[model samples]
Target: MTAQAYCPDPWTPTAGENARTSALVDRFVELEAQVARARAEQATLLVSLAEIAVEQGRRSGSESEYDFATRSIAAELGAAARIPEGTIRGRMADAVTLVTGFPATFAALQEGRISEPHTRVIVAAGERLDDDSRVEFEGIVVSRAEGVTVGQLRSFARAVAEKIDPVPLTVRQAEAMALRGAWVSPLEHGMAEHRMIGPAATIYAIHDRLTQAATKLKATARAAGEPDPRTLDHIRADVLADLTLTGTPTAGDGLDAIHATIQVTIPVDTITGIGDDAAFLTGYGPIDPDTARRLAGNAATWVRVWQHRDTGALLTVDSYTPTAAQRRFLTARDEHCRFPGCRQPARRCDTDHTIPHSHDGPTTVTNLAHLCQAHHRLKHHSPWRMRQGPDGEIEWTSPTGRTYAHKPTPMVRFDAEAEVLMPDLHLSDEPPPF
Candidate 1:
């Protein structure tokens, strides 16, 4: 029976294996199509809900009521789905635009030929165009979306939209200039992010200047045989800080005197060198104990905060004054806006009375919470209601009767430590150089 020995090519797939692979590929494609269809259906439903809300509000006989109705519906849906109301509101707006403004693109998504991202890009690109021009823009971009990646489609759609726009470029540029501004956000590992939005040319020029400065500094270090551990990115960031902090601005008014302010909450044991608990950077999250010590060392005054041993809620500060200490306590307890998913820094927020003072609410810590201006107005105008719970938790009840609880951020913990390598810069009893 050893007459014939069978051999199979290792590189080749058997018929059975080939059939299984084909089936797998087919299943993957089918799943992708299913997802696209699901997204399309969701968009349609959101649009329908918005329309219903608007119609219901129309009976109330005011535009303000109509707006409130839309927001109320969004908040209800957001609470039920565990999503941020602001995010859901934005999505509802996008859904309306997608279905009404760009029907062809929506149809493409419905047919499983394009994705949600593709529809978004197309809608955003053609948003400023007239109805006729938008239709023309969609006719071209929808076909391109099916073939190209989302990024490519975005670029193409932008170029096409610009060409088709009825408004002059100069007019758009002037309007866009009003929106130019800078903002900061906290990042992971005890770092903060700065973003500036301006004219494309001006932003690029500023970046180019930073790059040139960084390049020169690196070359000088290399020439001097200095072991410069910093990368170009690091040097560029440092140069940006240095120029902004030390270099005089062209208008040079009181800007130089305006120093950045941040509140840091350090544990007593951490400061006494008996513990390594992470310090909370107030608006930001946790920073290492060593950096906290350095910041504390440079401070002219320190307010010691007392916390409950069982719960980490802020009890009071060391101040004897009632109002000032209460303000400090509230700021420390509510690190940011108490509204669910709102992170507007507490320093910039208004201390809102959970129960109106007119209704006999006392001016105490439990009756007060920090809310950004927008959310504060939303609380008063919309059907949303909130009540403070134990340990600084805020329970928000949406119009549809769903509740969401947002707990106060902890001030002291050993976890969430971000290891940041300190740059070699001169530190003194003054505002931070960068």
Candidate 2:
């Protein structure tokens, strides 16, 4: 056998691994086709699931009962499919749109003529309208979706959405104002992404200022005969960071009052050296407990919120009153707009009465929820229905009769003894926990 030392057939370059650009392009084309087919199959499955959900709702008498059943089933579906719960909800929404509202788009998807992303663009473009308008809109756009690239299709879709929007211009302007805010999301390598959405004029003004400052910094470096080490983009980023952190254009040069309020919610045990669980950063998600400690220690004001131990649900804070306290509690509780998939932060949103005050709905926490101005108006004007569950969960029923549930993110609960002793323990005394 050793003497025979047999060799297998000489290996060939797999699809795109070789140096040929044409081979790589061909391989990509094939892959895209495969992906389209897979997406089509997934859509088919989702359509079936949507039909089942509708049927189940019809069978169930109460909306609450239907919601409970559907959510439980959704959890099961998410688990079996190995998808996140949020993703499953999004898929369900898309399925409803494809199967019911945009049958032509659905057919295109089934034939693998368009991918899921194209379908999403189509669906989102027509989302503000009822099924009839969507059908008409899809008829106009579906063919273009098949022909044009995704980016081009998106531009077309935006035009369509703008043309078909039923909201009056004055009302739309108000909604736009309410939607203006900033948010942060964690990124790879301990970096983060910060996004601010505002009026075009306001954003443009800010951008112009940043650009001017960046140019000046670069020019200053050149005049000093020092290397302009930073790119325009890098300089702009640094300038923005310096402006935000130090309340001045440059760090450590001239100090201005820090007027921004940053809220950090952390577990007591984490700061007490008992545990290392992540802490909550308002307008952001989890951060290192050490970072939380630093923020709290440096902050001029800190509010302690006691949460439930087992479920990590927030209980109450002692500092608030019946009126002001309720508002603060609602802000902490909701954290964001109660509408499904809407991430507009609670502080920026209007506290809406689930049942209108005119209808004798009390101004109690049970009757109130945070809704961005757009969604707030949408809820009031459209066929969309909202109700608060006994447990303070918000359930939204779409015009198509689909029900969605939104729950607040749970807070980490600390012990009563820890809460009592927290005021005595100074956050700055310990070394950096990192």
Candidate 3:
């Protein structure tokens, strides 16, 4: 037998050891400086690597400098770095901004007087100012960096940038409005965050409406001698979600028409209480079985999809009108865009024929896939090649002949009872006009 590996116990201060605790605290202070220096070194390396990528791009005459830098760094660093390529590119750009525009701020960061977050705040605001104005803005921000918190630093920098901006306030407002949109981010505890960027006045009005409804509901609960269980913030969030989903304050018996269609696929066994399998929310991944059943009960329409049990391959997609029902089937199968790394939901994407319809490709389930607008254009304009497998898997070939396969992540977890429930589910013979 091989020798057993030795694992050391984690270091911890003994109780009542004031000297050890003080020494540990002092060491930590020294480590903070070490960490800052390490971070500065890493930034320098990243800058050098990005410069090398630019030189390589010039020599190869193939990929752009940015594409080369992002792909190269992401590939070399791997996912353990926990930084996305876009973030890496953005940080490299910020590093340049700091070194060129705010030397004092960068020096403070290197010396551990200020942090990377502080540097980022300065760089972000300074980028908006003219060269002459940026120097003045940097002077104001860097002086306060060591003393102020990151949040305060951001606020101060923003204030300085606004005061020093060369563009007229109206023009800047127009530019800011052009950037408005909704963004989704993953959060802890199996939840996700939704952020909307828009006019402050419009947002405030919506918030006021939600607050009014929440307050009224709270008062109603109190008058009825019932506990006001949810907090004001929670009630407001629910109200916002309810309005956004159903386009009304109250969601009625069935799901209402909205901007995007939500599709949920649940095993018949779970729906009928035979099994506890979770349902797949088209773009959002798996939700609890109870939520699935509740949503299904309120669905305006449903399309039944059939697939092979063993391989999870599409068996026979229902033959329907080449419009609504067809879209439902594809959305159920693909869940999101067929692009290699994209997660844009099918509802917001365009269904494109894998083979060009101009070349006589039929508009059928086997020949169709959902692609976000950006990827759809890329498919047509770029040299990226695509092919569909017999089982609806997508194979993408990049311009450099690198091939990647994309298969939809299935929502169902297999159990022996799945076979028993299969015959009773998703077998609707009716295909009414939608």
Candidate 4:
């Protein structure tokens, strides 16, 4: 009897195969950079065309004619590019800003150092900065754009621009607050995206409170070991519907007993009226210190957190209940989900053991982190691995052997003397009295 040898396809790549794949990836990235440069060239040309059109319109007649010329130029370009004229006009305005107001950022794009999104973020963040400040802002942001993701760059650009802006955030925020309103934009599948533009703190507080009530509903379901089909997001949406339509949340049990809570980190000096440093709002970037003070004064409980003078790493907090203290520390440490670029607020996340408790992972502050339910499952069910350093930097490794290090956003503190003060909040928590 003769038997044929079995030969199966290779599941793992050889060294040479891996090298080829790496080279291909590098080439793909290079091509993307080239596309970005081409986009910059196109934007420059569009700006030139718009300028010429406006000049011609000015020579011919009135302001209405000039605007019409701009619109006509957009329509012409839109027809060529197969984009809507309205979109083309918006692009034209952005192009003008990029070419004229942000020359260095434009050059960075032209040289293929950054992409279109990066440029947009830089421009928008620096928009409130004056000419000299904008130039400085562009130079700093463009220099840092190469090594970071677009999201990271956006946060950095915004913080930097805020620090350097000539206008006080309080003044700008006041002006913006006047324009606050709510609107709805229709979407497909009988859906819509409800939008609101208002004070950042108030908006964040509203969301935080909603998330808290939703989380309570989820916890109640889990405690009963009942199979609830609705996810946290679904529950949040339903709760919002109940509150707005019926004036009370009727979606879950014991929601009336749940209290809405929000976390705000403010500097000691700022709270004491000594400094105007912006406070770090959880899940959002920065808010004016005055707002932070007001929020702190209105809270029902206060947690005093200490930090090193040189490094702003969290040192300690006055502890009460061990479980509650741990949750507070983790929430303060991980402002959002530990997953890279996931800004899901900590209040909506599960406190997960970096190393599973069943696997002898101790129930300690260093051993725990906050992860959204989706990512918590992903960590367990998938090939992704996480490791936390002593400094609270989390390093996540994928199945492909690539690692991503996510550092905790440094807490804004002057020294170990600061306290986040929360007095009794008289507002009702049931329907979110925002």
Q: Pick the candidate with the highest TM-score.
A: 4
What TM-score would every model get versus the actual structure? 0.47, 0.46, 0.44, 0.76
Candidate 2 Cα errors over 4 Å, as ranges: 1-19, 183-194, 204-233, 243-434
Q: Rank the candidates by lDDT, best first.
A: 4, 1, 3, 2
Deviation in Å, model 4, residue 150 alpha carbon = 4.2
lDDT of each: 0.66, 0.61, 0.61, 0.72
lDDT of 3 by residue, 1-434 (tens): 11111112234334456466556766886887678777777777777766777777777776776576567865565455777767777777666667767777778878988777788888877787778887788788787777655754554466556556766444665677798999999999999999998754345446656765776777677887985899989988987998888777672322222222345567778677776554544433334566556656655554455554665544333333255445555766665678865766565566776764545545566667778777776666656667776557778765545566776443333332221111011211121122
Q: Which regions of candidate 4 fall more than 4 Å away from where they truly are? A: 1-35, 111-113, 143-153, 184-194, 218-226, 309-333, 348-392, 410-414, 417-434
Steric clash pairs (candidate 4): none
| Candidate 4 TM-score to native | 0.76
Clashing pairs for model 2 are none
Report model 3's TM-score to 2 decimal places. 0.44
lDDT of 4 by residue, 108-127 (tens): 89989889999988898998
Number of clashes recorded per candidate: 0, 0, 0, 0
Most lDDT-accurate candidate: 4
The residue-by-residue lDDT of candidate 1 on 270-334, one tens digit each, is 67677765555543334456667776776666666554465444443222222554566666666
Q: Which ranges in model 1 have alpha carbons more than 4 Å from their true place?
A: 1-30, 186-190, 205-236, 242-434
Deviation (Å) of 78 in candidate 4: 1.0
